[model samples]
Target: MTSRFMLIFAAISGFIFVALGAFGAHVLSKTMGAVEMGWIQTGLEYQAFHTLAILGLAVAMQRRISIWFY
Candidate 1:
């Protein structure tokens, strides 16, 4: 159950990840200040780390817990 939840969570996060990257680059780049954009970038980096960690957990569960965990 946890594995399934993580997989779905990761998928949603991945979508948001791409959307945010595009938004930050194309939209925020023009309107925002450098320091504000830097902070946004930092937060995005942290979010990427956590999303990847969730993906990793899903992979681990597939291998270690059960092949059908997903």
Candidate 2:
């Protein structure tokens, strides 16, 4: 994908990351056990990191790193 599209995807993913995090912390915490909550938290962290990686890739694409990135 192009850098612009990658950025848009990253924005969407970031929004999802935040939304799911809030849902897990506020809503799931009450019902889910500590272990389950921990797992969810770990998954969210990974999502957040991956979202950042997407942003980085977008920047790289914008810089014209390679034709293969297009």
Candidate 3:
């Protein structure tokens, strides 16, 4: 997979991450219990973090960084 594709994928996932979080906060808050909402928020946090990490790596790759230790 190319770095461009990875970066684009990361960008799209980031948008999705925000949309889902907003949806959960505004829509699910009324229907879901506190515990469920908390879990959803936690999952979103984790997803955001991983996606950002991937984005960073993609940027690094695009810049031709020597990160791969192998």
Q: Supply candidate 3's per-residue lDDT for 29.
A: 98
Clashes of each: 0, 0, 0
Task: Please give, for residues 1-70, the per-residue lDDT of candidate 2 as tens digits.
Answer: 6899999999999999999999998999999999999999999999999999999899888997765654
How would you order the candidates by lDDT, starting with the best? 2, 3, 1
Q: TM-scores of all models?
A: 0.83, 0.88, 0.92
Query: Where does candidate 1 clash, by residue pair?
Result: none
| Candidate 3 structure quality by residue, lDDT tens digits, 1-70 | 7799989999999999999999998899999998999899999999899899989888888989889641
lDDT of 2: 0.93
Off by over 4 Å in 2: 66-70
User: Which consecutive 10 residues in model 3 have the weakest lDDT in total?
Assistant: 61-70
lDDT of 2 at 6: 96
Q: What ordering of candidates by TM-score runs from best to worst?
A: 3, 2, 1
Estimate candidate 3's alpha-carbon lDDT, on a 0 to 1 scale. Answer: 0.91
Model 1: how far residue 39 lies from native, Å: 0.6
The regions of model 3 sitting more than 4 angstroms off are none
